[model samples]
Target: MSGLLALLDDVAAIAKVAAASVDDVAGMAAKAGTKAAGVVIDDAAVTPKYVHGFEGKRELPIIWKITKGSLFNKLVVLLPAAMLMNAFAPWLITPLLMLGGAYLSFEGAEKIFHRLFPHADHEVEEDMDVGDPVHLEEARVRGAIKTDFILSAEIMTITLAAIPEGAFWMEAVTLALVAVAITAAVYGSVALIVKMDDIGLFMAATARTGFGRSLGTGLVKGMPKLMVFLSTVGTAAMLWVGGSIIIHGLDVLGWPVLYDTIHRWAEAVAHGVSEGLAGLAAWATSALSYGIFGLAFGMILIPLVTRVIGPVWSVLTGGSKPAAH
Candidate 1:
């Protein structure tokens, strides 16, 4: 009886430890998820455009497919690679993160470039009209998944960095929690954004009161504006997060001039302002400077990317395999 009681006590102690670990993982995942907000917003913003021009029936199906691909990217491909990075080449994470930051900056600048030089955009009409839509969906889905892999990689890396180093199991569980939470948040939000119009239409048709019907009508009209807002927010987030990453990464790498200079200048400018507002002003100024830097670097890379890198890569691969396996 005493031996059995001792074993029971040991089992209870083990269960308590397990429960604590679960709580730790959940806590880390939520905190880390918040850190990846920029990418999450961009993901939600960017996905709806892929569904554009598809028949209504196909839109949800496409989203579902892409969502699955995203899950696979995070869970199957990215999670394992990130684990290896942590295990073997932990030092490389910051530089890899910085490179991804540059990518976000480049994309953000490219969006600005498009707005400033709309004529330069090679419209996708021809590509959209590919003879076999089945093939097109597959291609688009493949492209989106590849894109998601990059963004998700960036997100996961940021999450991993945010978390404290614990036992291997602790880190693994934390990452898994982050992966599942982020995937759910990004795609769930995307689904809601995509389906709001349909929901509004249903409400408009079925609502009993004039106000309810008008509210539904308003929701129908509001979706486009919401999308525009989402895009604007996404672009801003990309710039902010990208620039912040570059600054933070440089600091971590011991090249701190750009990072310090921006803060110093912002603080100097903010001194005349109210104490509470001063911090806000300084932060905004620093962010703006970083964002401008990101934009300049991105714009410079764009031409090089298109003219030199694109052609060379195309020659090497025999087609545009930029996002191909």
Candidate 2:
């Protein structure tokens, strides 16, 4: 009887430890996911476009394919890479993160530039002109997966950076949980957004009540505006997060001038505000300052990227030249 009681007590203790570990994983994953919010928003916003113009029946299937590709990108490719980096080359994390941040900044700024300049998208036109639906779908899926790879790398890196150092297994589990949870959240939201029009149309046509019909009609009409809103918000988030990351990276790497200046400016603004709103004012000021810096940095990168890097990449990859921006 004593032996049995001891065994039971040992098992109970193990169970308690396991439960605590699970909670820790959940908490860490949530925080890491929050840190990667800009990339997550952009991923969700960008994915629906790959399904655009597809037959409604095919839309879900296409999204499923892309979602699978995204999972593979994050879980199979990025997760292992991140783990290896953490294990061996931990010092490289900040530099790599800054590179990713610069990429995000460039992407956001390029979007704004395109919007302002209103240039034609030759690549999009080429895709639209493709003869076979099957081939076009394949090409679009490949492009989207390629894009997702870059974004997923950013997400995983940001998540890894956010995780507090602990046991190796704890870090591994936290990263894995973050990868799965973030991929599911992004793709799940994409699925819903892509299908929303159909859902709204079905409701509008089939709903029994007048209010239901009106609501459905509203959804159908509102989706386009919603997409535009999401795009704008995603761009802003990218600039804010990217600039902040760069500044933070610089601070980590022993150059605190920019970071200190931004902090001082934010503090000055915060002190000028009423006590009740001081924190909000400071945060807003910091975010805006970061975003402005990101936009300028990104604009500088655009000419170099489009004029120099794009051509070099094309030559090396043996691909056609990128469209002129």
lDDT of 2 by residue, 205-299 (tens): 99999999998999999999999998998999899999999999999999999999999999999999899999999999999999998888899
Residue lDDT tens for model 1, 228-273: 8998888888888888888889999999999889888898979978
The lDDT of model 2 is 0.89
- Runs of candidate 2 exceeding 4 Å displacement: 320-325
lDDT of 1 at 87: 95
User: Best by TM-score, which number?
Assistant: 2
Q: Number of clashes in model 2?
A: 0
Number of clashes in every candidate structure? 0, 0
How accurate locally is residue 129 in candidate 2, as Cα lDDT from 0 to 100? 71
